[model samples]
Target: MLNRSGNTKYQIKDAQQVYRQLSVSYEKIDSTSKKLVAFADKCPNIDENDISSKARYATLCRNIRMYAVQVLQNFSLSTRRVPTEDEIKQARDAKQRSDNELMEKVILSIPGINGKTLELSEELKPFIQQYYQVLQYMQQAKLAGRDDEVKLLESNLEELAQAMRVAHQN
Candidate 1:
């Protein structure tokens, strides 16, 4: 009887640990998803003729969205509680709405800059600012055990660095 009780206690502790991990993962996924959506929304506007630049911007947004979806799926599967189809659809719809609203706000704020050509330094300014912001957020995400966010920020930093290098080269 004593051995059985001991086994029961151990099982309970293990279950608690699993629950805790799931909770933490869910919270991280939620927070990082919001950040990804916001970043996508705030992407800088580029000239209409700059097809390559627009492609790069679109790729970045796509990558961010993919990351968010991947994180959500991975966490849900790991917790052994896959979300329903309706839940997944709802999350995607919410993301779409948020992206639309944010993009509208960004477009309205930068009305005159659409077709204008910016100097190298003017163009690099936003990347530099974003680099610093990502660095700060990366630190906080690390402390919070938000590995998905950290990975995303690290990738953003790498892209910013490459962009700056190219800008300097030209």
Candidate 2:
């Protein structure tokens, strides 16, 4: 059997590996979320009945949910103990700020798409707001060590994912 120090070292290495994987996953999800939002902005006037438009919209919604889930999972893994209320609030604020900056960048990146971008942003506002709200709740639950609440929130997210998938079914 390994000595206590050797065992601890192995555990630390395993955790570092998991952290790296989670970081990579978060980056991919963030990139996909930004691309989807950009696509929405560029195609604001897309015909709802068009198969491609429906597929793209569904994909965007799915990506948002996927990003939220990954973020919650990452938080759950990274935190060693329950966080204070202040910490939770700080995390929530930071995430919102980051999201707003991303939105601004996405909007500014495509010139002459203002009207379309506005329309798309307006149409998606409810969904986007609700998704983020759920994500915030998930973060709180995870930080509080409420596994049951986390599972419930995950179920809600999965339902949102299913709705998006069904909306684009051919």
Candidate 3:
């Protein structure tokens, strides 16, 4: 490759080496694609009325609990010191997405799930948003070294966690 100043810039010194690497990558991708398709095909379709299908729903609710309190557990500034803004943003997005996704998945996929559970999932969307906002506020308080505010928010988080359990159980 030539530079703008008419200087030689050795972009790819061994063209054959690049070709070999690409061929290896292509083979791996093809193998992985076939495996993924085979795995998906082997999984049985979930019917909401089927008792066996409740297993996945149980797993999903377990994940919801994990996501609900994920930030509070990770953002313990006292344990690990300050998290980067990027870390906070990613955590925040996950927390927000977690709540919203509960309703979406329940509504779209599990029609035979209890009607009350579906409605509760829908309501939990905004509740999940508020849960993380308090988390953000708690993060700010921790940074400010205002233990008072942080403690209060910790209690609030506990309450939110309880509500989350209630919602998921519904």
Candidate 4:
């Protein structure tokens, strides 16, 4: 019987309350996990009657599961998408690796095309221009139903790969 806007507002209020409760629960879980691990570490795992009770066995299982999580990944308690510092570093590292690969390609392509290998390298655009142009033309040739041209370009690319290999060795 409520209006659409009123229902939406009520749902939003309910969601907010649920989120608050989840936040509080996460804090408790985080604290309990730490304390439980400490307590488990103190308990004798090998003794005959050390972890005899069901509750102690349950604690051991929880401790092992948490240990696995800690070892396997950067664990987070937040339900939302929160970027941790490690995640940011990983993203930056991946981008740097990609850039390094592209630069290596440009360097190899230049030597293959008989371009100058100068001490001070030029910009990425000029270095990769000819390589991209040839690649683009080859793709267009294939799409235009030019099988002969495609075959020719494929062989040319193979030759280029060999040349790049030679250049890489040097």
Rate residue 54 of model 1 by lDDT. 69
Error of 2 at 84 (Å): 39
Candidate 4: tens digits of C-alpha lDDT, residues 52-170: 66457667858766875564334344355445567768999999788667655655555344434523244434435445566778989988999999888777666665545454445
lDDT of 1: 0.66
Per-model TM values vs. the true structure:
0.31, 0.29, 0.31, 0.31
Model 1 poorest ten-residue lDDT run: 107-116
The TM-score that candidate 3 achieves is 0.31
How much lDDT does candidate 2 score? 0.63
Give candidate 3 regions above 4 Å deviation: 1-120
lDDT of 1 by residue, 18-72 (tens): 7778788777777776676666545566777777886777678668777877877
Encode model 2's per-residue lDDT on 1-88: one tens digit a residue: 3786676333444666677786787767777776766676456667866978767776776678677767867776875654556776
Taken over the whole model, the C-alpha lDDT of each candidate is 0.66, 0.63, 0.61, 0.60
As a TM-score, model 2 comes out at 0.29
How do these models rank on lDDT, best leading? 1, 2, 3, 4
The residue-by-residue lDDT of candidate 3 on 65-163, one tens digit each, is 555345334533334334556776899899878856754553343323343545554666665566667878999999999999999998887787667
Q: In model 1, which runs have C-alpha deviations exceeding 4 angstroms? A: 1-9, 44-51, 81-170
